[model samples]
Target: MSQNSLRVVWVYPDLLSTYGDQGNVLVLERRARQRRLDVQRVDIRSDQPIPTSGDIYLIGGGEDRPQRLAAERLRRDGGLNRAVANGAIVFSVCAGYQILGHEFINDLGQREQGLGLLDVISTRGEGERCVGDVLADIDDRLGLPPLTGFENHQGITHVGPNARPFARTRIGKGNGTGDGTEGAYNDTVFGTYMHGPVMARNPHISDLLIKLALDVNALPPVDDRWYEALRNERIAAATQPS
Candidate 1:
């Protein structure tokens, strides 16, 4: 990795890519290249040692057992924590989102340790699993459009004071705490429950990561007509009156 090229690490794909989460990294690479920025996309498996030099790291949804295993390896690996300490950006979803936090309930119905990068915690919510299309308003300060994605999880995440709510749930259970919140974020890291590869449905979030990682105020614009169309359709479907 060099200063001129952005290195994006896809962490533990062998374990955490239960959803089509690979699209998040793909979208980021595409958007960066659209600006003529060089990108090195690295796919790191669980057995390999994680590199802390990557500019961005992406983790994705997984089953409970995989989630537990990934979390444990990440903690022992220590690379993610060191990377975050050095100001690397992280974006994770669902199970990966939970792994970024202090703790989450795992498959054995036992509390599992997390990366402790985010202040949030995940606990099993009584009743049915939260599943379906979701519509959320990204934090007003971010100035991004409504975030649209799908959700399918049984854990309810509680955002702690150290982090800000990534979005307000407009049409789904979201964090499942009934507080109208969706995810959690600090300055360099963000966690979300939404899947649909997220970045494909909301390109702004991906751009946000690029801007933050590069310390640039703006990115060169790329055509987003198709993205807008898909976003509008998804948002409409998620928010439609039942």
Candidate 2:
């Protein structure tokens, strides 16, 4: 209820933690501890019932089958949608991101239902997989640093009118189209394809999510010079031609 205490629900880690996405959960925990905030993480597996009242809900990337399975389980469990409706901060990446949209095409070229939390749709691309380092400028209003990460996905996501892009790509292909835009954001739900365990690379975004989860205007600061330096280095590297 207060900034002093928070709860995070990591959804289906076994199925959705590909590409070190579990690091996102660790980043949130570490950042919260650095600010002296008490945070508890609860993992909700496929067979478990999702808690409807967590402050933050984290869903990460997975392979096609796992992604479909996770989506199906979440649909049946039926807590995530209600939690988001109640203002819980939801962060999803890659396949997890796709699963939050209206629908996503699986590896078999079949359309699968999503949670419909974001007004976006992901379709399987016919060409090469978009895989590389990415640097994106976060929305200015969010007061966050540029996002840096690795993107490896074949699903090209298209954002609908109801949802806004979380950031604009500065380098590398985003949403698998070399588009200037990347990710999708609506209210408390954020869906992105960045998979350098995005939170570990963009701590400011993590902090912002924490603040949102706590319903606070601001949170205590933690030293981020190292993180900033790493981010800038990666951005510069990503922009350089091979």
Which predicted model would earn the best TM-score? 1
Per-residue C-alpha lDDT of model 1 across residues 1-242, encoded as one tens digit per residue: 34357999999999999889999989999998888888999999999999999899999999999999999999999999999999999999999999999999999999999999999999999999999999999999898999999999988999999999999988998999999999999999999999998999999999999988988888878999999999999888877775
Candidate 1 wrongly placed segments (more than 4 Å): 1-3
Tens-place lDDT per residue, model 2, 78-102, is 8999998888999999999999999
Instruction: Report each candidate's C-alpha RMSD, comma-separated, in the order given.
Output: 1.2, 1.1
Candidate 2 at residue 84, lDDT? 87
Model 1 score (lDDT): 0.93
What is the TM-score (0 to 1) of candidate 1? 0.98
Model 1, residue 93: distance off in Å is 0.3
lDDT of 2 at 130: 85
Q: Look at candidate 1 and give me any clashing residue pairs.
A: none
Candidate 2 wrongly placed segments (more than 4 Å): none
| TM-score to native of every candidate shown | 0.98, 0.97
